[model samples]
Each structure stands twice: as C-alpha cells, then as structure tokens.
Target: MSALPMLHRAVLAACLLSSIVAGCARKADLVITGGMVWTGLSSGRAQPGAVAIGRGRILAVGDSAAVAPYVGSRTRVLTAGGGLVMPGFVDGHTHFIDGGFQLASIDLRTAATPQEFIRRIAEYAQHLKPGQWITGGDWDHTLWKGAPLPRKDWIDSATPSNPVFVTRLDGHEALANSAAFRAANVSKDTPTPPGGEILRDPRTGEPQGIVKDQALGLVERAIPPPPPAERDSALARALAHAAALGVTATAHMNASWADFASYRRMERAGRMTLRVVLYLPLEQWRDIADTIRRQGQGDDWVRIGGCKGFMDGSAGSRTAYFFQPYADSAGYYGLLQHPEASMRAWIGAADSADLQVTVHAIGDRSNAMLLSIYDSVARAHGARDRRFRIEHAQHLRPEDMPAFGERGVIPSMQPYHAIDDGRWVEQRIGPERIRTTYAFRRLLDTGAKLAFGSDWTVAPLDPLLGVYAAVTRRTLDGKHPDGWVPEQKVTVAEALRAYTWG
Candidate 1:
C-alpha cells in the first residue's frame, strides 16, 4: 500500500496558510468513502464517491479510486456506508442563540390540545423558582383541535407565580400570562403600538394576554435578559448542535448585537466552530454601515455586513400583510410591520451604503411591495451586487413571482414552514391563495435564487428535516401522503443545493 509521511495537524494548518508547503507532505487528515456524494454542482446529480479533507479544506472528492492517493497512515477514514455524503449545510436563516435556549426550554410545538399545552407549561414551571420568567414555549395554536388562540387566563392559574411569555412557533404572536402583564405594567388601557396589537376579550374589553408583533415588547421588556455568560453558553450549545448536524455555516437572519458580540468573541478566541453571517436589524442601517466601516464586515468566520428588515408578520398570526383578507379572518388583510415609505427610505439608504438587504415578507402583497422597493432601490443606486433578499417570501402573487427573478431578488425561505404551516394555512387563506403559497417550483422556473433555512427556534435546526419537507411537501400530520402542495415540491437535489450552496 502506498503511504505518505504523516504531518502534524499544526503543520497542516501552516501549509494551508502559506502557499509554499514543499516540506509538508500531501496527505489527507480525514477521508470518507462508500456513499453517494453530492458535489452541489449545477447538474444536481449525485455520484458514488470518496472525499479527502485536510486543513479544513477539500483535498479530493471523487469515486473511491480517485481519492485513494490522498489516504495516508495518519488519515482518519469514515465510511458513509449507504448514506449520503454531501456538502456541509449553510442554514440561510436562524435565530442562533435563541435556538440554543429553546433546545432546553418547554416545547409546546407538538401539543395536540390546549390542555396539553398548558400541561407542558405547568409541568415545566414546576421546576422553576417562583417569579422566574418562563419563556421559549414555541407553541402553535393551530396544532390544537379547534385552533384557539391561547389567552393569558388559560395559563394564569397554571403559572400563577411565574411570568410567562411563550411565543407562537412563528414568533409573530405570543401568549403572556397575567403575571407577565403585571410585571410589564401592561393594563387593558395601554394603547397598542402601531404594527402590533394587544388582543382583548370581546365581552369585557379586558386585555386577553395575546400580544402581536411590535406590542410584544410590552411583556418581553419585563422579562430579564440572560446574562452575558448565559448568552455565550447558549451560543456554544447552538454551535455544537449545528456542527453535529453537519452545518458548516449559518446566516443569522435577525440577530441581536449580543449575538454578534458572542460570535466575534468566539471567533477571536478560536472557539468559532461554524461560520456566521450576522445580519443586524435594518432599522439600524446607519449603525450597520458605521460598524462595517470600522470592522470592514469582519472575516469569513463571522461576517457582519447585512441588514434585515421586517415587511410583515407571519400567516399563522394573520399579520402577513396580504392583499386580500384571510378567509378565516373577516375584513382583515393583515398589517405591515412598518410603513411603506419608511421601509423604502431605509432600504434605499442601506443600499447606498452598500450593505446587503434582506426583509421578511410573508404575504403576497408584502412580497410584491417589497419587490417594488427593491427595484426602486436598485434603480436609484445603479447596478452592483445588491443581492436583495426577501426573507420568508412565503406567499407571492402570480405576477410578483416573476419579479423575483427579473429583479434578481432572492427568496430566503424556510422549507420546514411549508410543511408545518401547510397543515392549517388553507383555513386561513383559502384554496385560491394556497396555490401560490410556498411556490418553490414556479419560483425556481423564473430563475430566482432560493435560500432555504430552518429558521431555527421557529422550526427544527436540522437541514435534513428541511430537505425532507421541501422535497416531499408533506405536512407534519400523516394526512398529506402525497404532499401538502405536491406540485410545488422541489427535488431532493434542488433542496440540498438551497441548504448548502445558498
């Protein structure tokens, strides 16, 4: 057997850093074979393969015979067997730190009944100290039998001592307990903030404890934030979780300053296990611009040059800024999170500053208007690599679908949402609107770029689950055997590319 001299891992790193590595032998640090390998090429085809990796770089990738030379005495070989060997996933969207905390928090995502929902929260609260804030439930009202929006009263007795602030899986709405209300000083008379609403009881006109969109700050502000160490620890768990799933990098779609600091500190300390592209809130475009000027968008390990804006809320919350009223919600066409003019101005300013812009637009009208804003912004600034992205472009009008490709705007979407939301979306939007919802096939046909992610903390962090959801379009329930919207179902290869290359 041919063998190459073994070199230390540190020497391999030096060889990778410096072009001249004549002294260092060409040997693989890790080798994997015996599987179907996807190179993530334009062809979207998988080949029987082996891969040799060295110094955190792909030294060789081909059929077993091709990469055999790279295998050396020190090479660590892993057999994939019949499994798939593909490129590391690039999660296009995530709430990284929050996802970590949620990993250990109460899970109401699968609570099939309102009783079970309360039960989970109540049981989880039993372990917490009195007056301690209970957060990160990620409950879905749609999962319940009647799809009832949970009221604070429902869980008030259950969590009498704890201040509870549990959000819907979509993160657009939340159920805050009475304890939370008192802590936050949120009374029935408190005026609701624009772009948000505090739901109230129809009979007594009392606050019902359901907070939507911007008004969420009322209760959220009351809950004490995790300390720096805790935040850092959460980041560590999230990174470990992501790496375990073969995720090499992530794009934190709506990141906090603390999240960026965590990533920066980790990268500086060589604790960064995965890459991060931190996109700050778009409203602070000026700050993002200034930071870019000061830090030069950081290195590839942890970049920070993009801004994310919100165009609307989610469909689950009936706040997706649609063109028409939801079938279930009378006279409600949903609402935008920000005024059109304000969004346009901020987007234009950010474009002028040359920061990548991505906005959340889940409704058809929201996507349309945001597209127009992108078009106008790009036209105003002339042409460069703007790559304007529409995060959660979940619903699109037929006409606006073409605009995504024509205008070169990317639809940064979560495929898991297709399956999860598909379970109840028809009741909300009706059959007519459902045709265009999560229209991955048509969007790809239009030559639009697709960026798929888990929206972790909102959905599962596993990209494999996302791939299954996208390829099958199967709802979480067993009902959709064929698929939820089978016609819109993308191929495994296509979905894999979105999870990796995008």
Candidate 2:
C-alpha cells in the first residue's frame, strides 16, 4: 500500500475509537455549570466550573470542560451565572421551630423605644381573639437608653385583652404583661425558683413581670401551646427560610420529641429540603437512647443522637453562673442551672451511653465547670470520638481559655452575639473581663474546633451576617467602627471556614 493511504486509514481508526468512547459515556441527571465552585477540600476552588449530579449524589466536579461529557439531551442544566457554587451552610445550633414561629410573629427586635415595643405587641395582639396568648416578640430593650428591662406596666394596658409573654432577644429572659402574670398567678409573694429570678420593684416590692432563666417558664407554662397545624407551619416556614439563606443543615439545640416527629413526618411526606440534627434536653437522655437503640441514628437527612443541657444562663440576663459577682449587680454571682454533682452525673451517663453531649456555658464559671466535667467524663470513658461541645461558649476566664482545646472540646458559638452583645456587655461584666467575651480567635488559636451558628430567634438566622460579625466584630449599635474587642476579630477566611467546614 502507498504511505498516504496507510496514514489516512490510521486517522480513520482513531476517529472511530473516539466516537465509541463518547457513545459509552453515561449521562448525568443534572448539570450545573459556569461558576466558582468551592469543593470544601484542600484542593481549593475551580473557577468557571461545573458539577454533574445523578441519583441525588455528585458525580463529577471540576472545570466546565471536564464535566461536559456528563451532559446529555435529558440532563437538566442550571447556570450559576458567575455566582459562587459552594457547599450549603450548616448552622451548628438553632431553635428551629421557635425560629420559624419568630419569623411569623411580631418582630420587636427592631423596636427602639418603650412605646414602639408596646405598640408592636398591641397591634399583633389585636389580630388574636381575646385571651389568645401572644408570644415570640424577641424584643431588644438595649436599643433604648439605660437598657432598662421592660416591666408589666409598660404593656399592661396595650395588652389588656390578651396575655403577653414575650422573650428578650437572648431568649434567657422574658417580659410578661399584667394579663400574663395574672394568668400565671405570679405575685410579689411568689418565691423565686432555683436558677431563676423575678425582677421586682425596688421600693414597692412588686413583681415587675420580668422573668429570667428558668423563671420565664412560669409565664410560658400559662400560655397555651400552639396547635399541631401551627407547629407544622412553623417547621415548614423555617425550612424554606433556611433553604433561601443557603443553610443546608442545622443542629437543632433543645429540640423536643415532637420536633423529631415533625421532621420525620416531613421527610416521609417529601416536604423536607434541609437536614436536621436534633439534640434533645439532657433530662430526656434515656428516652433518646432508647429511641436511638430502636430506630438507630437516622440517615443523613435526620439525626437524633445528641443531648443538650444548660450549665447556666446567658450574659445579657446576668444569670450566667460566674465565679465573681457581676459588676452591675453587686455581690450577686449568677445562678448555676444544675448543681455540679448532678451535671457531672448526667454527662457521665450520656457519655457511657455513647451519646454526644453539648451544654450551654455562657459565663466564665460555667465554662470552666463544664470543661472540668467534660475532662472527667473523657477520662472515665477512655479514648473515643466523643466530640463533646460547649454551646454559646461566650464568656471565658483567661485561665480557662486553654481548656477547650486541651480537653478536645468544640466551641459551638454564635458570632452575631459578639456584635449584638458588645453594645451593652461591658455594662454587665465590666471592662477587664470583657476581653475574652466571644473569644473566637483565642479559641481557634488554642486549637479548639469552631462550629459557628446564628442562634436564630435570639439573633438573625442569616449566616452572612454571622460571617460579618465574626470578621468585623462591629457592634450593632454602630459605636465601634474599628470593631468591638477588635483583638478577637478573625480573618474572613477563618470565619468562612467556621461557617462552612468547622
């Protein structure tokens, strides 16, 4: 044969082989292209990238050209349009159902004055039938001068027909109107509950209708629980809101068994769009363990193998069990929700059951105590991937800072609280101790795992706002342009890592 004919034959054979390979390539169910794709891995990002999905799992992720083979006539295509294509956010802690209700209830978070707070509640109450309990205001009294906690008298007249028991923005305290107090039978003679307080008038000795910590339950118990329909609606609303904000999963703190049932119902009904990890109250650990034993820890969409407990209250409410008295409240050390002995026992039991335990520790004393408890529990259990966490590890003593990493504890913190509380935290704890408040950088530097959250319903649910707070530490009051406790401000990269991967 001639040399030219032989070369032409070789070229044709190569073309046929390429065609055969292309014909055998499987098509993807969906193809997402044209964006900056962050793989959430060490390989870094892929610019102008594409992702192919099939059978509800990612099949390929790389530059657009690399994924082109997966696209077929039946494949659904989505263009990112130069936007970011990253892993969906995972909110480490939330009161998911409560946040859903808050989204639908009157928003008093923006009420800047006493009159505005009353007006908003009154207007919201007007829509309800007489005797309907109004809840979920999430009011922020700090916006007002002096930041005086609201009293019953402030909204008594406005809420004459309805009982009003609205929570403070931190969810650690609540203000009840006269109607609410009357319904709860709260009186000046009523004894304060352990680990709680009922703020009273100084001279008159009358109950001011401001309840802190566990005392909020006094008024809360008097209010009727929302109907099943309302509960379902709240969960649905929250899920939609989370999806819109790019939150793919949330570890719901203080979840009830009812919440778990609702989540499972949603999953079965094909209404669930986001993943949920439920941490029931520590008191229910046995029930949770039994349930887990029977059903097993759930799939990727729903998990139920964690217990949440409170060591103390929050800083804003001044019940955050502290080693020393609060600067504003002379001789008054905050209250501990659980006795040291009881807390240790519960934690040990949970650890033995192989359940993850995360406790809320907002004060230096509480954080230190919980850390000690965790260390003791770890020693007893031997080495394991316990991953015990401290929720709202907000205030810490300088000496206790190293214990987090040393003890293999995760600091599940909310960054927005730093900026939100910065507006008035100094008034509660004073200047020197405020240095370690919301110590994100310090915690990270100590080698503690960082799991960021929004504490939605107490603060905004938007993770972007959380990132801003983490990176800037700018007070919501607009007083600190350079950043509040600027020393604690983390780099944007660090903040993003906490939100996404940590």
Candidate 3:
C-alpha cells in the first residue's frame, strides 16, 4: 500500500472520533433517571426513562441511555427509584398566606367533640399573651355526634384572658368567645347585618357566639391585625410548603392588597420559590385593573390576572343558596352573599376590564345564578378567552351541567371535598341531589375543563390526596366502602390533568 493512502485513512478515523465525542458531551444542570416518566401527553409511559434539565428548562426527556449524554460533572442527579415522574402540580385555587398562618396556628379541625374543641382552645390560649387574640383554629363541628355549633359559653372560661375568634373548617362561620364579643361591642341587641346572621339562643334571644357568612366581620373587625413582619413570615412558610408539595404554581384566590404587596416583595427579593397568580376580591376589580393597566400584568413569577367573588356561603354552614330549602330547615333557603343586581354589576364591570372572574358557588341556586350571569356577560361582550371560573362548583342542577362546557367556563373544583363532605352532605341536601354533586366525570364528558385545587386550610394541601378522592370517591368516614356517588368518579389520569395541565 502507498504511504499517502495510509495517512488519509488515519485522518478520516481521527475526524470521526472527534465527532462522536462532541455529540456525547452535552452539559445539563440536572438529570433525573430510573423513573416511569409519564410525559403527561396522550401517549403512554416512558419506562426506564430519564430527564435532563438545563437553565431552569427541560433539555431532554427520553430513554435513560438517550439522556445519559447530557450528564456533566456539575449536574445534580436525582434518582426516582422506580417511582412515577411527571410535571409539577399547579393548584388552581389557594389561600396561600392564610394556609401559612394555619400552619403556625393551632389546628382544631380534627377535634372530635365539644369538650375536645374547648380543651384545644384552652391549651392554645395558654401559649399566647393576654392581649394577643387567638384565631385560625378551623374547627369542624361535623365530627361531633350532633354537629352542634360551638357557643361562647363552651370556651369562655378557657379563653378568659385572650380574646378568641376562631373559624370553622369551611371559613364561612366562626365562634367568638365572650371576650371577643365584648371587644367587638357585639351585644344581643346588635342587629344582624344584611347577608349575615348572628345566631341567638332560641329562648333567651342572646348572641350564641356562632356568627355566619358576612356576620363574621362583626367579630373579625375587632381582632387585631397581624403586623407586617408576621405576615412576611407566614408568606415564607406558605412558599416553602408549596415547594415541598411539588407544586410549581398556584392561583391565590381572594387575596387582600397586603397579600399582593407581600408577594411582590418576595419576588423582588428573589425569595419566591414558585409562580403565583393573584386574584383580588371582585369588589376591588377596578383597582386591580388600574394596577394592571399602569404596570401591565406582571411577569410569570408574580402577576395579577383575576377577580374572585362569592355568590353564597359554604354548605357546611348551611348558607349555600339552593333552589329549595335544606332538608334540616324547611322553608329556610340559604342566603345569598350579594344581591343578584349587585353581582351582575360587579361581574359586568370586571368583564369589561378584561379580567378573569372566579366566583365561589356551592349550591344549585348559586351555581345556576352565576351561570346565567356569565352567559349574559359573554353574550354582551362577544367572545374572548374570558376563562371565567366557578370555584368549588360543588353542587349543580342536572340541566345546568352542559352550560359549563357550552359557555367555555372552567370548574375550579377541589376533589377532596367530595369525600370529606360525603360523610353527612346527604343529611343537608338529601340523597336526590347527591347524583350531580362533585360530578367530575360528568363535567369532563360535557367538555368542561376541570381545574383542580387544594382549597388549603379547608382541606389538605396535597394534590395526591385530591387525586385519590377523585379516583376512589370513597368517603373518608369509611361509610361508602365502594364509593360515594360512584358515577361521578374520575380516573387518576383525568384528575392529574386537572391538577397539572388544566
């Protein structure tokens, strides 16, 4: 062979070797391997797969060998250990700051009896200073045998020094100790405000400490507000909770201006661990719109996008407006939080400003009314991506089910409510209405988008628990071994999509 031919062959082999090394040496900031990766697409599993991430974005996701090239000296590798790997969950609704405060405060949601409830308050009060008010217990009376509302008399002696104003698990009603009432100047003679009810003794006509709906403000206004430092701490705790839960984003519903300021401060300081979309109260829609118009709807990490309102109160409190009176209280239909005309005006104004609107509608009447209002608004405004949502769309009339999909409305639902509320909801509304309650499968079949959330503080913050509830429909009380309204149950994948993509 000629010497020239040997030299050319050697050069060609060197070039090929260099090309192979270059192709196998790409860098990644992080790599996750050994997982059953559900790409979250319609296509099924990516078994024994790996993911490569770079500069805060997914660089590659495929077979483990395919992603091996992106691993580098500085890359952080996480092993899934045969567990499922998918997109981080997005909570469609949350009271984030409130959840943080709940984490730090005494939790009474698990209290089983009246005595237990009083004992918990007594213990909690001892930890606080005399002037410091005790709040945020989130007690649930439904756990008790009779489901009796707590009275001031029950906790007055225990919370003598510290004024106590604690809410129920639903946050719609609250029990105020005698000290709190005196501090708020709420007397037996104090007339119940419109859209609110101050429960009084049947014979004595004295305030019984159980305040429902708008009446909660009567005592809440008197409680000292938390200082800015405390608020910041709570916000930080909530952010940490979100990160630990594998939640990448959350929509904060019914946040105050102070909450918005705190979120901005966190973002500015680079302390935010997840994305937040703040929704101010519907009454403040004009203010939010002005802020958005001036500053422009903010960046991905912090943005103002929607307004939240309430058509009625929660079912547990018996304030969820329904088409017919509750079974327990004949001729006593639930109260509407706002007049129909007022709701129309507020919704119309918000719609005109091009802000997304989400209203808390729990009962058949409230849901139907809101649907009508939304339909009217859509007809007048023509079509844009309004994405108007009904938070907690817990109960619905069968006829109104199709409107959600037809109108392009989103049902921002919390699956945990079905199992939690199932224990005794039949007693409140009766078995006939239970068919369409938490109709997850029915809504999806009708083409309505389902956005899942935790409604934290009212329920568990974990999305996995939510998925379990949706898929199983088994009541937490173990009464329904098979399922509660089994026809409404949805698949695990469907629930996951609602928590993530929806």
| lDDT (Cα, tens digit) per residue for candidate 3, span 39-107 | 545453446677777655555667766677788889999999999887678888889999999999988
lDDT of 2 by residue, 15-60 (tens): 2243532453668899889888765454444456777766555556
Model 2: which ten-residue window has the lowest total lDDT? 1-10
Q: Which is the leading candidate under lDDT?
A: 3
TM-score of 3: 0.91
Ranking of all candidate structures by their TM-score, best first: 3, 1, 2
Model 1, position 165: C-alpha lDDT score: 92
Q: Which candidate, 1 or 2, would have the higher lDDT against the true structure?
A: 1
Higher-scoring candidate on lDDT, 1 or 3: 3
TM-score comparison, 2 vs 3, better candidate: 3
Where is model 1 more than 4 Å wrong at Cα?
1-28, 33-35, 63-83
lDDT of each: 0.84, 0.83, 0.86
* Cα-based RMSD of candidate 2: 9.3
TM-score, candidate number 2: 0.91
